[model samples]
Structures are given as structure tokens and as C-alpha cells.
Target: METPASTATAETPRPVDRADRIRSIDVIRGVALLGILMMNIPYFGLPEGILGSLKFDHPGDANYLTHQVIEILFSGKMRALFSMLFGAGVILLTTRKEHSAGLSIADIYYRRILWMVLFGVIDAYVLLWTGDILYAYGLCGLFLFPFRKLAPRYLLLASLVCFGMLIFKGHLRFQDMRGKREAYLKVVALEKQKKKLTDKQKDDKKAWETVVKNGKPDQKKINDEIKNVRSGYPTVWAYYLPINTKIQSSVMYEVYFWDVIGMMFLGMALYKLGVFTGRLRRRGYLAMLLIGYGIGIPLGWWVHQETTLAHGDFGRYLDSHFLPPNRMTYDIRRVTMALGHVGLIMIIYKSGWLRWLTGALAAVGQMAFSNYVMQTLICTFIFFGYGLGNFGRLTYYQLFYVVAGVWAFQLVFSSLWLRFFYFGPLEWAWRSLTYWKRQPFRISQPDSETVVSSIQA
Candidate 1:
């Protein structure tokens, strides 16, 4: 007869192996981070309206083309990828310390989230632009821990509920626009046919021209945008209120949480299926990737196009704001496109060609906590009065250059930092503060001393 402890050990799955750790997650995160720069670059350079306007008009055919390319390439995809990663992060952290008895895990987690919220509030007011996701993410983190033990099917159902509800909400809005009939059809026709913008349309062109032209933003633009951000822009304050922001950012932040958690479940399922660290046969994942991309990308593209149109609903939606709010098609498509991007990341991870790309990217991913805060710090200097003070001056195209510089800085710094230290600066500090004990800083290795562990290994 087997004892209960021995019986339990016999049935339990093994922990993830050191060599078996998944790089796909890191790779996907890296790609998402870079892709984020594509969208953020514009904000870093231009005015708020420019982000939306570029979709409809540009300075010329070239500018129009540039915006279109970015829309297809970056647009909604990166954010979705980040959201999925956020979901995955929850699973990772929960498991990291599941067996450790000496740690006050829940207390530590609560403090970590509190610190995150504190940093987010500080970042929003002092240094960076008010388009802060950190604050939203931190608030959401508080509720995520409880979901860690949910079964896969249940996880899938929750994700679908979160994602599907958003789409359903969007579908009604689109249906309403179709009922109005004239404006919706006209806008679609113009976009599909690629009609040249009339003079009036030219002035209304949307693109990030501000940040590119100005290295930092002019003080005036910063003050104006901040005011608009805080005011939530013409009833925008309603958008940011805890109630409305919760709903508005619900799909934006929490939806990603669901998707990511779903992916972690998917990843767990895949792990059970034998995929990570080369355990799964290439052909298996290859088929899944191909099939997934084949369907997901085009579908993503279509929905993305649809959501772009939802912005047009602003006036109509506002006109009837007093009534039960009208739903729009744009919302429906955002969910569809977001799903497509998730499929794309899954496929890319399966490709196996992403080793170098994933490795460097994982470097950034490993230090994501640090890089995230670093992004706030760096962008503040580039965009706020404390630094060059040129927030709303640069154009969209010019932002690419600044991003390149930052990318170079982050990549090199991340790689170098990892060599000398065990964690990114902030990450180390976060751990120390959370646990109230200083973790070891360096590993003493009797090495020919490789470049990998530079600080004190």
C-alpha cells in the first residue's frame, strides 16, 4: 500500500525544467514591446488628435502610406500581445513561490501592487504623458491572484466572456451606424477607394507630426494635452473616472489579462502536449501555427479596419449620449483583431527561427519590470519639461529615430545590467522592498569569467 504523500508525488506533474523554459513567451513580449514603440512613438512626438487623424489623411500619399503600414503592422496588435503577456505574468509569479514557506506571498504581492499604483500615479502627474497603462494595470493586478487556480476550460470561458462581451457590445454600435446608413457608407467608400483628401480634409489629416518635429514637447502643448487628458476631453473626465475608466479600460486592460491567462492555460495545455524547449515535434506546432495564422491574420486585419471606423461614431454616440448608449462596429472588430494578433504571436514562437531575436528580447523581457519604469523615466525626459521639454513638437516619422535610440539604450543596458547584477535596477529594488529583506546581489563564480555574468559572478 502506498502512503498519501508518496501517492500525491506520483500523480503530480513535474516543475518546468531549467532548459525547458519557454522562450516564446519572452520572444512574444519582446516583439510586443518593440511594436509598442511604434504606436507610442507617435504620442511621444505629436498631439492627441494626430493619432486618430493619420488613419484618414496624411500630408501626402507617402505619409498616408506610412500610417497605413503602421496600422497594419503595429496598431492594435502590440497592445493585445502585451495584455496576453500580462495574463501570463500572473501564472509565472504565482508558481515561482508556490513551494516556498518562509515567504508571506500574499502580503508581498499586495505591496508590490500598491507600489505599482504609487509609481503609476507619480508617473502620470509628474514626468510622462497621462496615457498611463501602469495605473490601470496595477489596479487590475489586485484581482488577478485569485484566478490562478481556475481550470483551463473555466479560464477559457472567462476569457471568452470578457472578450466576447466586448465584441457583442461593439456589434450593436456598428448595427446602429448601418441604420443611420449615409455617413457610415460614405466613409467606408472613401477609405476603400483611396480618394484624395480635399483641402479641408487635408487640414484634418491625422498623423504624429508634433513629436517628430520637436525633440521634446513645447510647454504649451504639454499643458494643453495634460488638461485634456485630465478633463478626459469634452466629457473625457467621465472616461477616466473610476467607474467609467473601469469599463472603458476593462477590455483594454483586463481583457488582456483574460487573454494572457488563457494563453498561460493554453501554454500549460501545450506543455502537457509537449511543445516547449523543443520537446514537441516541429510538425505539430507548425501545423497549428500555419492554421492559426491562415485564419487569424486576415480576420484580424478586417476587424482592425472596422474599429478604425468606430471613431467616426463619436459625434453620433455623443449626440445620443443621453439615451442608452449606442454600440458601434469598431468595438466588435477590436476584439477580433486582438485575437488574430494572439494567433500571430503563437505561430511566431513555434517557428523556431526566433532564437536570436527571442534571446535578446528575453533579455528585455527578463527585466520588463525595470524596462517599464525606465520607459516612463526616459519618455518623461524626452517629452516633459524636466528634460528637453519638447512634448508636442515632433512628427510621427521622426519618432522612429527616438525609439531607435531608446531601443539601443534599453537593449544594451539590459544586456549589460543582467551581466553584472541579478536583476534590473527596479526589479531588484522591488523584490527587496516587497520581502523586506535584501536578496543576494551577485553570484561568485570560479569562472574564466564569461561576459554573461559581469557584476560579481
Candidate 2:
């Protein structure tokens, strides 16, 4: 957020030094960043496919132990927390510049996102996994451009609709899966009526049992699991019609894109309402937490559980069904959970004790651009093709080592770098590119008193 005075100082070439920067947002960003890795660490430690599995798919004593720890601790919740921060940041940065004299809000905002799209592409293609949210976020930011200036209530309504649409779409999928519920009933009924369970029942019993108590994800087992998803599950898109596929594409785009935008708008609205400004009453913040937590978590957990029950089972017979069954119930829950993420932020912010965690987190968030790339580079070195080639090899528990190692590295480096510069290196580059000027990279400043004396002489 370049202020009017800051813009003037830039034009006159007043050098920015250590004292000129704001610590609060940087702290906030750093906190958000640290939390992101807590979410990403498991992915780093495991094969990519294990992301949505009911059970850790790989085998071996070492890998099996790894999976359990990750599922229990670093699963979905932390990432959801990071997404809320991204939303808050969108508002924080944009609003800061909105009333400034130099960079037009529209100009800087669009250029910023355009640059992010390029960055996301490169990150996706060359650095790490192609499943990059940054690219989706870049695209989604465009949709948010027009609504930035609408009245808060209007923006609020728009965001709600987009989010609600996501929920509705999920509901439709859940309903579709319900028709297949009868199949499960038949299998269970048949097994029970026989007075002895068959092989199919045994397999299901296996799914319910959670194999981890007995095993770990070993390379040989991972190879087998990968083979299973790729070969064992036949590619029967027979039920996945072109229209439905298109619908899916659109739904996913909205799901990833709009959930983020909706949160940003909500944050922006909150900001306008003076929440982020620290003006909201304690009760108000408390109320938000209660509402979000009370409503969101249970709803989200229900969705997660239902979806797992409904469509988590992959069957040779389901070659007839292309769409996943838990769509709708789960979708509704994701939306509520996302709101719950906001509630979490408020709770954390209100806590004086959380300053330490938030400080570490903000350090990461401040260098998100750099840290995000760094995460990929380090993980690829640890797991991917170019380095150890350990993908599909490490245990789920071993993931913590990777995560802890990376967290230590990022924390030390981000703090060290901030000491010498106004922005993270990538953040500097982004701002420079967006402004289309060679912004100063150095923080050293000329003596103003000396210049004044010289002018008087």
C-alpha cells in the first residue's frame, strides 16, 4: 500500500529505509506464510495422490508411521487457515492503495494479478507440482476486480451467491451419489443374509479398518498403490458426459476461485466495517468466532464424513459412475468451513498469547512469493524427480522431518533477509514489475540535513 506521501517521496526519489515500512501487515503475512507450510508439509512428504485418500495408500513400516501423523495433524484445517489470510491480504493491500495519489488502484491491482498469473505458471511448470492454486487465484482475482467498489452489502451479497452456488453444486453431486446408496445397501444386505461375509465385504472391511495401525507407506507399496489408481481403477468416463465434465470444470473453477474471492470480499467488508482496523468490539469478534465455529466446523465435518461414506469407495462396478457421490453434502460443508477459517483468524488475532505464532507466520506470509517457490524447490530437492527422486518413497511420518526442516530454514532466512531490505526479493521484483520501473533495491539513504545545508550555501 503506497500512501500519497509515500508516492510523492518515490517521485522525488527519497530513498526508503528500514524505518519506512509497516510491521503489522508484514507480521500478519509472515504468520500466514508459516501456516501455509503446516498445510503443505504433508503433501511434500507424501505422493501427490494421497491428498484425498481415506487411508494412507502406500505400504511399509516407515512410510505407514509417517501417514498417520500427517493425517492427524497437518491435514485440511491449516491450509484453510492460510486461504483466509490470502483473502485478508487482498483487502489489506488493495485498500491501502485505493485512496493513494500515485498508483491507481485499478492499474496496480490488475497488473499485480497479471504478474501473479505469470509467476503461477512458471511455478506450476518448472518448480514443483502442477496443482498450483496461485494460478487459479490469479484467474479468480479478475472476477473480483469489478466488485471491489460496489457497496459493502452488494459485494457481500455477490460473494455469498458465488459461495452459495458452490454449495448448491456440491449438493447436487451428493444427491446424485444418493441414488447409488441403494447399491451399498444391496451389498451389505446380501452379505448379511448369507450368514457369512464374502470377499467384497472383506475388502470394505479393509477400507473401514484403516490399514495404518498395521502398516506404513513403503516404496514398493506406493508403487503398488500408484499402479492401483492408474490401472486398477479403470478409466470409465461412461457416466462422465461432456456436459457433466464441462460442469465439473466450471464448478471446480468456481470452487477454488470464488471461495477465495468471497472471503476477500468478506474481509474487505469487515475492513470497511472497522474490524481489521481494530475498532470492532470484543463481543463483535467473539460473536463472529462463535457463529463461524458453531455453524461451520460441524457442517464441514459432516460433509467430510458423508462424502467419505458415500463415494470414497472405489469399485470395479462403479465404472458406470464417473461423478463422485459426496459432491453436494461436502460442498456445503467446505463453504461453511471456509467461513470457519475466518472465525479462526479473528480468534487468533484477538489472542495476545498468539503473537509468537503470528509473528513466525507473518514472516512467511511477507515472503509468500519467495517462500512459495522456495517450498517447491526444497520439496522437489527432497521428493521430486530432479533431486532425491524420492517421490512415492518417503513415509507419511517422515514428512514431519521435511516440514520441520523447511520451517526452520524459512524462519531463519526470512528474518535475516528482512533485516537488510524493505521487501522480500520476489516481492520487490513483483512491485517493480507491476509499476514498470526499476524501484530501488537498496535501503541506504542520503543525509537530508547535508543536502539542506548544501542548498542553503
Candidate 3:
């Protein structure tokens, strides 16, 4: 009879070969990172909600076209791709360690997540970008470790369940909004008729009024917000700091947690299915592109048009509500577009037609953490009062010029930095802190061969 350890060894699947880094994953990650910057640039250069409010009054205007294109192509898709990649990274790290060391790496992984959370807090609070996703990513990562061993089918099913829950919650919220609007209208009617309102009715009317004011802010209020953000650093910081705290707590944990975790689970399932490893057939990839784009692009375009026609009014009613269609179909559009992107990137990688560009992208992916932070630093310097103080100045189309410049810089800098160093600056620090051992930084001549092979693999 075999010993229990031997029996368990036979039963469990062997660890995957992680010695050779997957070049395709890195390339796709790089693409996702670049796409994310495209979406973030608007937020960086303009006041919050300005892009959403900018009316495309004329169809021929460049700004209107730019807004439409960004909404259709980039909005949630890049973030979804990034979240999925994070899930794939979790499996890759934990399984590789288990395979090589013959033991669980839970303790070290937890430490890594803790550090990531710390970094996220710093990024959000210190750097002052209220739109930071790192904090949410860090928090969600803590919940992912236990599910590492789940089967791919179960993982996908769980993801769908999570998504369903989000959709259900959204429906409930929409209904609640409708009820409030009806109640508020009744109160207005009573006031017009010179009838008295009960104390409870008065309170309900006040609450609904506040909601309406916030959802559809007046033009003067929008201009004031723009002026405030365009003012000095102290003024802008004071205005946004409290808002950031609320967003970091409620929005991050409440509204976005489901979306992030659902994509992560999908990512893990895809990874297990060999989708990210270039193992899927060309026909399968082609099908993903066809079905994904066929459904996602047109639906996204419809939402964009609907939202634009509403002039960005965010009311409760379907006809009057700003971007209601977009809100309703957000997950479906983003996920399908993300799948389409993955299929496109995989095809490009397999063809070996753009090795130079892919290689550069892989470098950027390798140092994603560093590049992400660097983007915040650079953009804040450009737009914030302490730096160039150009906030609320650039138009939607002009923002793309800044994005293109940053992309060029990051591509060149990442490729150059990796040529000499073993890891990106932040990645090195993160690894050292997690492992409690200082990792090697400078690449020795002998190590150069390994680094090149890893990059090219």
C-alpha cells in the first residue's frame, strides 16, 4: 500500500512549467495597459464628469467623435482585461511555487497582497488620483487565494453567478430610483395644489430633490467644479480628498468588487483552459473575435448614441436617464470586447508578424506596476496645480496627444530599463518585501542570457 503523501501526489495534477515565461501573456498585458491609459487620460486632463457631460451637439466635431470612439473601444474593456490578467498571475505564482518547493505558498502570497494593499492606499491617498483601481484589486486579491484550486468549469459558473448578482442589484437600484421619482412627483403635485405635506412626505421630497440635483447638476455648478479643479493644488486637494475617501470605501468595495472578482474568475478559467497559452485553435480564436465584436461593438455603439442623445441626463426614467443603456449592458459589452481583444492579441502573437512591437509590449507588461504608478505621477504633474496646472483645459481630442506621448515614452523606457535591470524598480521592491529577501537588481553578464530567453519565450 502507498503512503498517504505518495497517494496524494499521484492524485493531484502536477504543477505547470513556469520556468519559461509566457510571452503572449505579457504582450496582451502590455496592450491592456496602453488601452487603460487611453481611458484614464480624459480624467487626468479634465474635471470629473466633464467628459460625460460634454454634449456632442454637432456630429462632425472632432471632440464628439473622440468621445464616441473612447466610449465604444476603451472604457471598461481595458480594466476588465487587467483584472483577468491579475487572476491569471495568481494561479501562475502559487502553482509555480508549489511545484518547485513542494509546499503551499499561502503565507507569502498573503504578504504580497498585504503589501499591494499598502501600495494601493499610497497611490490613492498620496498620489491623489481618486480613480485608482489598485486598492480594489488588492482587496479582491485577498479573497482569491482560497479558490485557486477550483476546477475551471466551477470557476466560470461562480463568475457568472457573481455577475448575475450584480445585475440583480442594479435592477433593484433602478426600481428604487423609479419609486423615489414617483414619490417626489406626487409631493410636487401636492405643493402645486396648495395641499399640506406630512412630515414624512416632506423628508422624502428633500431626499429625492438632493438626488436629482446631484445626478443632473446645473451648468453653473459644472463650471464651478471645473474652476475649482483648475485652481491651485491646495484648493483641488481639499475638494477631492474627502470625495476620494468615500469612493475608496463605498464605490470600490460595494459597486466595483463584484465586477473585478467576476473578471478574475473568468480569467482563471480561461487560463486553465489553455486560452492564454496559445493552445486554442486558430478557428476558436477567430470565432471569439467574430462573436465578441459582433455582439459587443454594436451594443456599445447603441449605448453611446443613446447616452449622447440624453445630453448626459442621469434621471431614473429610461427615456430621460443618462447612459441607462450603458449602465444596463456594461458587463456584457466590456467582457465581450475584452475577449475580442484577447483573441486579436493571441492571433498577432502566434503569427510572429510584429515581434518588435510585441517584445516592447512584453517589457511594459513585465514592469506594469512601475509603469502604472509612473503614469499617475506624470499625469498629475501635467494636470495638477503643483505642476503644469493645465487641468480642465484640454479638449477630449487633444488629450489623445498626451496619451500617445506617454505611450511612446513608456514603451521606450520599459524596454531600456529591462535591458539592464532584473526587474522594474517597484517590482524588485515588492518581491523583496514579500520574500523577506533582497532580490538581485542589476543583471550580471551570465544572467543576461536567461533574461533574454525569458523575454523572447
Answer with 1 or 3, whichever has the higher lDDT. Answer: 3
Instruction: Provide the lDDT at 102 for model 1.
Output: 50
lDDT score, candidate 2, position 374? 84
lDDT of 3 by residue, 1-457 (tens): 8998976655443322224678788888889888899888888888656665553656768888887888887788999999999999889888763321332488778888999989988887788787888888888999999999999999999899878878877877766777777788889999999999999889879888887677553677668777776677788788778978998888876678898899999999999998888999888888888888898899989988877665544442443663246567988999899999888888888888788888889889888999999999999899987788888788888989999999999988888787677678998898878766576687666366655653543
On a 0 to 100 scale, what is the lDDT of residue 181 in model 2? 47
Residues 328-373, model 1: lDDT tens digits: 3332333444444545555555565555555667667667767876
Highest lDDT: give the candidate number. 3
lDDT of 2 at 230: 31
What is every candidate's alpha-carbon RMSD to the true fold? 10.2, 9.5, 5.1
10 residues in a row with least lDDT, candidate 3: 10-19
Best of the two (2, 3) by lDDT: 3
Q: TM-score: which candidate is best?
A: 3
Cα deviation of 189, candidate 2, in Å: 13
- Tens-digit lDDT track for model 2 on 1-457? 8798777764542223333333344454454555566556655555544543423333345544444333332344445445545555566556652233466778878888999888876675445444456776677777676665666687667667766776676656544444344445556677678767677765655543343222333556556544432321122122113423443356546476666666666655655666544466667767766776676555554443444443334333234345543443433444444444444555566565566555555556667788878887787566544456565565455566777788888877775565445567888888888878766664454365433221111
For residue 411, give model 3's deviation from the true position in Å.
1.0
